[model samples]
Every structure is written in structure tokens, then in C-alpha cells.
Target: MSKGKEMEGEDEIEDLCRNDSKHGSKKRLVARVGGSSSGEPQDADYSVVASLSDELALILARVPRSEYWKFTFVNKRFFSLLKSGELYKIRKEIGVKECSVFMLASGETSWWAFDRQFRSCKKLPILPSDVCFQTGDKESVCAGTHLIVSGKEFEGVVIWRYEFAANKWFKGPNMINPRCLFASATCGTCAFVAGGIGMETNWKVLNSAEKYNPETKSWEPLPGMHRKRKLCSGFCMDNKFYVIGGTNEEGKGLTCAEVFDEKKNDWDLIPNMLKDSPVSTSQSPPLVAVVNNELYSLEASSNELKVYLKGSNSWKNLGPVPVKADVARGWGVAFKSLGDELLVIGASSNSYAGHGMTICTCFPKPQADELHWRSLDKGCTNQMSHFILNCSVMGA
Candidate 1:
């Protein structure tokens, strides 16, 4: 491209970016004072740096987020643009988004972020909650730019939020009623959590639910679920929050699932949602995800992937996942919706214990003759343990 086109692109980026920081002005003044007296070149010297051609711009605009790590190798301009998050801001301004994976593995101190293709990986800052919170079981969900993780702390149940834009972890804006083992889901900028074990005078399961807003940094109570439950999974489909397959207060596996209707401000319970799937005491919450408004689940006992027949409230098996889901009853696996694909990360059945985890994705077609799974070449995915403790996917 000619100088005119390059200048046009840079000008466009600056127009779209947030540049109101007073610190930026101070830094520019210092640079000008330290250099030429005329200072006419200050603007040129302080030009917002980024490098991409017309074709490359089209290619990188909305690809899998995992491919971002390669930008650091492209050139220093690209590296600076990414590290400063200006590119992400630019993409957001243009209304383009792709999903990125954030996961915590067994025996790891820090959570890691993987791009969609698993071609690049970056370690997030370590969560600073107390040891009790770190050691206990946790539930994670994403709303807007906040990644919220709830766990039991020494003080009691607490929340930790990871802010994507700042690249830092923040201690709540906690729940209105703090609890653990709850069902949670994200829709657009809001998150809904429901039905978990709460403690008072004794161990008791709860029917209460709450909605969290990242913008407000606070949780608001919602109408309770139909039945008190724990060890359930949650997801958003068709703009509704649904919780499924949990143990009731009497410690019995429940086939009923509940959907929260925001307009009605109430929950509609659906029975026999998981009647066909086995539910053992040792089994983990149903491994479920939603892609393009369709619900899918991983059957831990059979290592099978099943799609929910929403109209009939039944399930149809899509075939098996490439992991040992049955080994730990689906406890240590990461199952999440990655844009248009279903992503699973866990130890393969034949993989040696304590070895690397396998990452697989599939573009599921409901009732397709054969479900195809493709294993991508791993990047830094092998750096952590094979077991996944918590996982959340966020649009970036």
C-alpha cells in the first residue's frame, strides 16, 4: 500500500480507539521535551503503531481468537497493538467477535487462555483469593468482559472476577446471597445462577437464584427454581437460562430441568429432561454446552455426546467424545461452546495418566449420519495437567 492508504488506516484506528487518558498526553509531552525543540515530529513519533495490509486486515478481522498469539511474531507493531488491547477495541467497535477459551487445570496455580484453534495460549494472572477458596470446588461463568468464579473461602463463599480489558483479577462485588455448587449461565452481558447447597444451621440445598450484571458489579436475586438442587449445569439457549440434571435436597438425582423466563420473572420446570441418561452419586454435573441455540451434553457413563431434542425434551446421541469422560465420571473435563463448534478438553482414554490433555472440536449437525471430531495440534495446552477443574468461554 502507498503512504496515503497506510495513513488512512492508522487514522481510522485512532478515530475508533479510546484515547482520553491524561497519562498519554503527559507521556507525549515528556517525549517532546526530551527530543527536538521544534517538536513538529512529535505526532509522527507518537503515532499509534499497528501494521496490517488490506488483505491481512480482512483475514485477521474475525478469526479464531487462538490465532492472536501469532500476531506477536508478525512484527513489533502488531505485538504492541495486541498487548495494549487496541486491536480488540478496534474489533469491538466494528462489531466483530469470536470466542476464546479460559480454563483452569488440576494442579495449576493460574488459569490459561487458549485461542479457538489452540494455536496460541497465554497464562492469565493468578487468582488472589485465599487458599480455602483456591482449594475448594468452584463455578465459573462469563458476562460481558468479566469472568466470575465463585468458591468457598475461609470467610465463607466468595466471588472473584477477572477483568479482560485490564488483564487483572478483582475480588467481588459478591453475590447477594453467597453460595457454592450453584448452576450458572451467561447471556450477552448478564449471568444467572441458581440452585446450590447453602449453609446456615445445617447443610441444606437451596432453590434460590440470582442474576449478575458485570456493569453493576453486583448480583440481584431472582425467583427460585422449582426444586432445590446442587451439582447441576447451566446454559443459555434461545435467550433463556436453563439448569439441568442436579441432585435434589434428599440427595436424589433429578431428571427435571428449570428454565427462567425473564419476561415472566418466573421459572418453568421441565420434567424428564435427562431421564434417559444415568445419574450416579459419584457423577459430576452434566457436561453441557450450547452452540447456535442448540443444547448438547456429554454422557459421562458412556462417553457419548448427546443433543437435546428441545421440542420433545429428549436427547439423541451424536456419538462419543475423544476423552476418558467415564474415568472420573466427567469431573475433570472442559466442555464449552466455542463460537460455532463444541470444544472438549480432557485426557483421552488411552493417554497416560498425568500426561497432556487432548483438545477436540466439532461442528455438530443434529442427527447427522455421523458426527465428526477433529483434534487440533496442541500448542502450550500440554503445559498443564490433563484434568480440567474449571472452564469458561468468553467472546473477544
Candidate 2:
């Protein structure tokens, strides 16, 4: 095989060792803490390669933005190995090459990948500059192997699908009406989208929702919500889907929430949203998580985090999201628990004009009620900073 075009897919890389002498037949690459070795470093060569496969797997589990990119320049050998198609699976696992913030004429919208990670905001090959979206309000949901995006840039809403494995985009079944700022979720082989507002000058509220099945590749209408809502939030939990918190046509915030059971093919009202600072209408979906056996949510717009105990059926306001609402931009909060502590990722534009992005991590600072969501970096801001955004936990 030629060195330039040595192999076919990942097999080419595996075959590379057998066919080429340049990659080095006998010398193995090692992982170093500080930098690379002439080959692999000497101090930890054996241990590094001994666990190279597993270590690579762990590195792949890291989110793509800052941590994953750090590994690319670690060493020539590591970079070569990661360039293989096998690493595409890792990139896919890490949600690399997914949606990034793309600024549009209408207020900014986020375009996500099948997995909602690694986004390219500046140049979208197929997505026109006008198209943008935000996933399930509470937490961005993964677009399935077949995924769809809705909402609009200036005039109206249109839904589109992304084929990840094929690296192509296709139009999908449309919604009953054009809307933006609604909740969209995917489970198994189907996708459920509902409740947003119209884009036309009228700015009418939407109560309609729909489901798309991969098997049929067709959409079937679901009963519209009891309330016509705009700016609502929805997510799937315990195999049950929930929609919560959005104002109706009257422009009053809603405490009423609802859930859908797949087996029954029906929707039912759940508990009212926990009483808090008057429900924030400007807020995106309140960030949600399940930590320490309780369901916790963070309202960056309201600067509040609340925990709900299923066992006791009660709510407790935990700690205010360590950053001010003005400081927290869309996609600001990325939540993941490291052992016993819940980590909250917060980022906001340094200015309303959206010149840059600021990222901060909120974890208990060795004490209670003293949360420190420290800024990690500021230079990586993308077009998505102007609107809603999300950070998903990556698993190897």
C-alpha cells in the first residue's frame, strides 16, 4: 500500500504496521505526562502502551471542546493513531464534529450533531447560514443515527434530518406550524417535537406536537398540549417523557407540566413546577440532572438550582448557580457529577454583542454552600454563545 493512501478505512491503519516499515516495526508509542518521546516516552513506556488501548478509550470519553483537542497534539504517533477511522468511532463517542453555535439573522440558534457534541459553527457544509436550533430545553438531546432539526432563521420554521454515518443531510417531515424555542427529544428509533412559537411577524404560540418513526420515516401527529406554549422545556426520564415550564398565549409563565407514557400512548399531567422565583420566561429550559438519588435542576436565568427527592416528593433549593444570570449565556451550563460532587459548567458572552465566550465550572470548593464555578477558558467562544447551548456527558 502507498504511504500516502496506505489503507482502506481503519483496517488500512492496522495493515499499515504489516505493510510499511516507516511506522516502525519494533518501536512502540508511549504516553507521557509532559510531552512526547523520540518514539513513546521512556519513563512510562511499558505502562503507557500496556494500557494504551484503555487509556485511549478514557481520553475518548472526555468532551471534545477543550479536553479532547488537547490529546491531538500530544505526540506524532498518537496523532497518527487517532487519525485512523477507528478513532472516528471514538470521535463519534465523544460527539466530535457535531453542532456548534452558528449565528443567524434571527436571534442565534444552535445546530447540533447526532450526539449533540463537536459543532462546526463557521462553515456548515449543508446547513444554510439561516438555519439554527436548540435541543430539548432542559438538556440537549442526541439526534438519532437519523436526526431532525426545526425552527427558522428569519421567516419560518422547517425541520431537517442529519445522517451521521453517511455525512449527509436530508429534509424531514414538517411540523404543523413554524416555531422556534420549542422542545425536541429522541428515544429509541423515534423523535418527538413540540411546543414553540411562530416565526412570522404575528409571533403566535404553538400547542401542537408530532412524532417521527424511523421504521416508517413518517410523522404522526400527537395530541396538542392542553396549553398553547412557547419557550417550553422537555426531556425523557425513566423511559417516560416530560414537558415542563413555558408561558401560554396569554404570556403568563406556566407551572403546569405533563408526561407521556409510550406503552399507554397518552399524556398525563404531572406535578406542578416547584414554586420558585416567578418562572423565568427569558430563561431557556431549566438545566436538569439526577444526582445523589434526587432529580436536580438549575435555572441559570433565575440563578437557582433545586433538587427534587422522589422518595419524599419534595423540593429543596440547593445553591444558586454560582454565576449571575447575566453572565450565563445559552449553552452555559454543562452538568456532570465527579464522584459525590455535581459539576456545573457555565459560560456566557463577555458582552451582549457576543464578542467572546467565558466558561466556568461550578463544584463544591471543599465546603458546602461555597460553590466555585471557575472559568476554564475564554478564547473558544463560537457563534452559539448568543443563544441557548448544552454540554453532554461523554461515555467511552
Candidate 3:
């Protein structure tokens, strides 16, 4: 072959390699560069490799949050994906969420959490030294991904915020009005506490209300309710806060209820909650919660779960809680909505016999007859003797 013809062929081969590289065709570029298809370069195709990593990130985001920490050790890329908020955004978009139950055991300073996916209980970090459980109206509410626990202590009213991402608790801003047994609810990133007994001399019932903003780590006062109530049940639904079934300043059970609208910063009086149920004056405050954007309440006397129908402005009896024969009805009981299940934690009647705790989960059926409940743990009944401060459902 002539030198000029050979040089021209080499130029053509070089031009082909440049074109393939520009078009992102690395496979053909490798074959031509090595001058033989049999022994092509063994290096990875970086563009395809990157695409695989992107796909893996999307898959990992859908994994249960309980397993996210373990996935961080898989690789540097995995760690980055888990640490970034992108995973959570994707999970939200896909509606992939898991709710875990967080409980503050009576008389115990440490908080314990139950993971639904694992069906296991793990202790969170110890509470701050300044924080102690006192005999007052203690409350726990899930605000976004954090848990805010507020209660009366010797030091006065204190609030602590726990972040699941950090696996730790930090002291939050103190409440402007230190009261216990108040109605509390969480809406969006903020939490609201309203109408509780004051910490002063007689522990008088109060009509005051306040809100906490986690982003600013500050508490802002809200318009006080029309009635001074203590031990009222508070819950958030559709961005509205409802306070119901608590004692008034005269220490008498109140049948009427009120709703607070955040945007308007006003309270609207609703029909009496007890008009239909006719709760006895001696009965304790009803346990109330919002599940699936609907309100539910468990009367302490009958232990029957009722769903509030706003359209009708009335309550529908779901049925009596599946209280064990051993568990004394309505003794130190708590009701919370966790994910798709309703969880009840209380003490068995045999609690005095050294039983530790009684925990159960209820699955609601479309038909009343199909509704059922299952006991998750019945090992301890003794813990029932002590007060159950609060129960919260959080996304892990």
C-alpha cells in the first residue's frame, strides 16, 4: 500500500473514534481504539455506570426508613443518597411511608419506640437532665418528622424535641404559659397547646392557647379559647384544631366543643360532644385522635371507639375496644392511630400481680362485624399502675 493511502485510512479511523465519543457510544470507540474486537479495553463504560447509580438511588428511596441506616454502609453513593433529603422527597412522591409508635413509659425518663416493620421495641436516648416526669398533664405530639414532648416538671413547663434523623433529643423553647393537662395538636410544622390548668397556686383551669414553631424553635401565643378547660382532648384534622370533652373552670365536665382555624386565627364553637354519648360526669376525659383525616374518640367509661362524622355532626359507635378479660376496663389506657392501625396500650387488671404492660392493635373493618383486635404484647401489667404520659405515631 502507498504511504499517502495508508495515512488517509488512519485519519478516517481517528475521525470515526471522535464521532463515537461525541455521540456517547463508548463500546464502538473501545473496539476501534484497540485495533481488534477480540481484545477490547476492559474499563467500565462510565456513562452507563452512572445511569445504573441513578436507578439504584430511586430504588433505595422506596425502602423502609427503619433499614435506611444500614443501607448507608453499602457504598459511598448509597450513603450520600440516604443522607440527602432527595430520598425522602421521592418516598413522599411515591406515597411510600411507614409509621412507628413512640411511647413514653410511665415513670421512665427514657422514651421507647416500637417499629411496626420489625415488631420490636428500642429505647431512645435519655432525657435531658433538667427534664423530669411530674404529676401533671404531659403530652407528646408528632410535628413533621420530630416528636415534641411537653409536661409539667419541678422546673416548670418544659418541652423537648426529638429528631429521628439525628437519633437524639434536644431541648426546645419553653412554653410561655406553663400549664398541664392541656389539649395539644400538631399541624404542619408547628404544634398547638390549649386550655389547661395553670401551674400556679390552685392549678386553675385556663383558657389560654399557644403554638410552637420548630423551625424557629419558638412558641407563639394563639387566641385563647372561649371556655377555660382542663384535661381537654385536642387533635388536628384538615388543618383545624379541635378541643373537646374537658372540665371547665368550675371543675365540671363540659359537653360543648370548639374548633380553631389556624389561617383565620379564630375559634368556632361546635355542638356538644356529650349530647349523643351522654358521658357521665364522673368519667375521665375522652381520648381523641385523628386517623386518615377523620376524628375518633374513645370514651373512658364504655371504652367504645366512636368516629366523628362532620357532615352529620354526630358520632358513630365502632364498637367496644377488645379489652382483655384480665385488663380492667378503662384503667390507665391510651389510644393512638399508627399508620393504618389503631393501637391501645394499657395495664391488665392483673397488673398488680407483676405483669409488665398490655399492648394491642385494632384493625377496623368496613363492616362492624368484621372489625377485630389483636394483642401485640401482654407481658407486663404492673406498669399499668403508673401513668402513661403520652403516645405518638411518627414516620421512621
What's the lDDT for all of these models? 0.78, 0.50, 0.66
Q: By descending lDDT, how would the candidates be arranged?
A: 1, 3, 2
lDDT at position 46, candidate 3: 34
RMSD of 2: 11.5
Provide C-alpha RMSD values for all models, in order: 7.0, 11.5, 12.2
Candidate 1 pairs with clashing backbones: 66-115, 66-116
Candidate 3: tens digits of C-alpha lDDT, residues 1-396: 799987875675455445545756535333222233443333333333232233234445557777776665545444544454445544544445778777766676677776763266667898664435544556787765678887656766777788766578887677788778788877655788899888763788898899887656678999989899987778888889888878887777788899899789999888676677654445555677676787777666665778777777887888776543223334356787776677776654344552446667776543364357777753333343334556788763
Please, what is the TM-score per model?
0.81, 0.56, 0.73
Candidate 1 clashes: the total is 2
lDDT of 2 by residue, 168-265 (tens): 55665565555677766554346676787766537788877777775466777887777777777666556666677778889888877777777887
Greater TM-score among 2 and 3 belongs to: 3
Best candidate (score: TM-score): 1
**TM-score: model 1 vs. ground truth:** 0.81
Using lDDT as the measure, name the better of candidate 1 and candidate 3. 1
Winner by lDDT: 1
TM-score of candidate 2 relative to the true fold: 0.56
lDDT of 1: 0.78
Candidate 3 clashes between residue pairs 3 or more apart in a chain or in different chains: 137-181, 351-381, 355-380, 355-381, 355-382, 356-380, 356-381, 357-380, 357-381
